[model samples]
Target chain A: MTAQAAQADQLASSHGHLVIIGGGEDKERDMAILKRFVELCGGPSAKIVVVTAASAVCARMWETYDRAFRDLGVTRHVHLHLMTRHDANDEDLIRDVLDADGIFMTGGDQKRLLAIIGGTALDAEMHAALKLRGACIGGTSAGASAMSGHMLAQGRAELHPEKGSVSLGAGLGFLHKVVIDQHFSERQRLSRLLSVVAQNPYLQGIGIDEDTALVVERGVGIEVVGEGAVTIVDGRAMSTNVAEIADHATPELIDVRLHLLPAGSRYGLPGADDRDARRIPPPLLEFLENITKRNPIS
Target chain B: MTAQAAQADQLASSHGHLVIIGGGEDKERDMAILKRFVELCGGPSAKIVVVTAASAVCARMWETYDRAFRDLGVTRHVHLHLMTRHDANDEDLIRDVLDADGIFMTGGDQKRLLAIIGGTALDAEMHAALKLRGACIGGTSAGASAMSGHMLAQGRAELHPEKGSVSLGAGLGFLHKVVIDQHFSERQRLSRLLSVVAQNPYLQGIGIDEDTALVVERGVGIEVVGEGAVTIVDGRAMSTNVAEIADHATPELIDVRLHLLPAGSRYGLPGADDRDARRIPPPLLEFLENITKRNPIS
Candidate 1:
């Protein structure tokens, strides 16, 4: 385990689960990501709160998600959008967070999410729901980006690991030592995520491709869901010359480990009682080996 | 102390000092803030590094500070600006952080600073220099905002406390729990600051007017310097209907304590050896009392 990741807390709340969907989940097709989300909310009977605070068109976002969840058999659904900071501190809004079994954040801008709900009473309440009430909190795209403690606020889709490629902000901070990038492959965000990891070696970067999700079950492990792949960049033991490069020069990275997780594969995060050092499951290891055999980078 | 602040680290590392300057510091007249920074770095003999990563006109910023430091009689000076992530990872840049007696950040865009140098080797070096090497690290304007762990990335100078007025991001994070706002009175950022405090009750808000500075000594206390006032907004006991206000309606703030300290006033922080409960010095207290008597808001 890496130094920081070893000390970093689990992505899941133990009592709750986290579904971070890379934007563009197949809503019109298999709807696998959304279906899994609803199922994780204890299936249909869950009281789900759809937060469209991040969306520019909140009402439309709510309508679309409401319809999707309803189709997935979710009976109790509510829409809570913050038009301003005032709404973030409302008692009713906080109550909504407390009462939610599943809290879903829609895509728009991560900055909007932080501005509207970052550290307000409603923010406290949402955390309370996740930690205390065991509510499953999830989001997509900008929503997914807001889950990390050190959030990636904005950045261009640079192909090279150069400086000024990304800007980070404080997220809802659901997870630590991990930075998430949405629409990973589709948006060509690999270099962005790499830049993030290169800056903070202790951090483990996870880039989720479109139509995919990285499901974190606190203290258990992470599972990839949907059609695309989940890329994990581990830089704990890596060596890099990120400190001495020129203005436009690409950074040189060595010993950085990359893991590709497809649907149905499981990678374990060491839990409180996690023993037997090998955290990777045998099946997951076998899959990695096969993939390694198929395409050797070195 | 507020819950989060109770755990928040001191603004100054135990080994170093912190000088956060509001924007437009007087480079022409007294230059008291700059003088203090220089003095803290052990005077004219100190080797100083000025980081202009935040500025768009990097060369101009470097030239301005270079002249100021020279006027202050500092012989050795270096300029380090990360034009790209590569520069941030440069070994020479890291060495400069280690070798410098004082490191100063210039005013520009806080977001730009984060984009160029937020998490790179240079960021790590800056932190290391302060914490381990006992080098005094300081900044002005956008530089000041970046000192806080939870930085106020951008915000409008609204006269009333309202939502959607500001966006918070990840700062250099030399300090925690406390948020700093530069060009406070000049920009009329009271409502903006109030909104910040309301959203994050755990954070103490420091709004420094232009030409002024807040000097924080680790585990010791803070002192005001320069021409203008430093507005300290303590919302630990304040109550707000922020969780339930309308979109444009001003937030009703109750029980919030505001302290306005002019130059030469010393405020006490609860250090490890802070024995007495009374933190405010008797003279400072008298000043506050006199001001309160002069202007009774209630």
Candidate 2:
């Protein structure tokens, strides 16, 4: 495990559960990811606040999700469409979000969503609801991308990694240790994700495939759900020849550990107690062991 | 004073002092800023370590700083020139930095310095040295720019603020509440600084002029020194008409409080005791009162 993960583990496990879903989650079929979100939010009586700021079709998106939640038996839910910054600071709206059992953000443009809500009174209250009140926070697509403190704002997809291809921006900061990217397999965004991880080795990169979701119990564990798998890119023990690369050029990364986790599998996050029990892939183990031997702490 | 400053004031006032100097500091004439840095490091008996990773001419810069410190009567010092990531993880190098009385990072390219030292054992030790050992830390130019958690990597200087003009990157993170911009007046970076503040209103913008330095005694107060004035941009209660602006367009910010402090002036940072004594600029006072009245907490 990386030192950061260990440090995260040491933090008090009091923060709320984060249901971060990739784009195109199965809402009509089983609604498995949404179901888990509702379950975590106290089921039928869940006071869910749907944030549709990211979507261009805010009203229609809200109506669709409102019906989906109602179909899943969620009786108490509110739609919050923050078109402007003023909407974010609405005292009544802030109070509603603060009192919510679950706050879910829908998909569209992550930048637009953040531009409206980032650093506002509503943003502060959303953080408080999750950290202090243990309210379940969920997001999909652009919403999912906005979950991390350092977000993948926009980037081009490619098989080979290129420097300066992926652009990063400030997110809502619900997650601090990792960078999240959605529609992984659907868009072939491995290159962009790798570029981001290469640039920022301290941050772990999690690429969630379309229809998949990672249920993160902050400072504890992550459980994968939905139709596909989650790609865990560990750059902690990575060795990259990025210095040799020129500006806007492709970077060469060596020994970056990649873990493919399918649905139903649970993985220990930074602060998990049973970290040793989860088997490390051979390549990752070898890489980590080499790093430990080379850089032993006195 | 902003809420962040108030929170910073509440923190234990036990952290070390930070001598963050803007570019073009008067090293030859009087050497006032460097002398203050040396004094903060416990005077002549100070064990100072000079990090020249930012400079392309690392050896030359080290020798020049070495002579300056020596002329100021600092007897014990070491030079750290990290060209690669391996040098950043070097145990001996890490030990030297951690054991130093003061750690000074010279100017060059902030990205190069951060890319080499960021997320390494050396980076961790640097933080520990400042937080745990109370070791006075000093940085100039690019070094000063890299002191904040959110850094302004690259941008153009314009009279009007553009949305996508300024590019940001992760810094060494010694300072968390504000974003530092160096050579402020010389480069005409007010537009970019305002743009950044508009995008991320949670962070206050600090523009340090050439030959000026902001001496931050963490968790206590900030004292400006040298020839020019330091421009303080508070965006906490700012109202921006950014939603109306298109992509890569200029943003209009209203109610952003700007404070100009010349050398010898002191301002209470977060956790400061005599906050009330430091007169709030009339406009800022009116803005704060309006916010308090509008957003009254129950």
Best by lDDT: 2
Q: Cα deviation of B267 in candidate 2 (Å)?
A: 2.7
Candidate 2 positional error at A247, Å? 49
lDDT of 2 by residue, B166-261 (tens): 888999887775788998866666567877887888777888888889887655556778877576667776655566667666553434555555
State every prediction's TM-score relative to the real structure: 0.45, 0.45
- Candidate 2 structure quality by residue, lDDT tens digits, A139-224: 99999999888999988874346667888999988776678999985676656787888888877788888888988765455677
Candidate 2 stretches with Cα past 4 Å from truth are A1-298, B1-14, B269-298
Worst 10 residues of 2 chain A by lDDT: A289-298
Q: What fraction of the reference structure's interface contacts does model 1 contain?
A: 0.00
Q: Is the docking of candidate 2 incorrect, acceptable, medium or high quality?
A: incorrect
Per-residue error for A288 in candidate 1, Å, reads 70
lDDT of 1 by residue, A204-288 (tens): 7788888889887654556678877676666665555668755544554544545555555455543424353235644244322
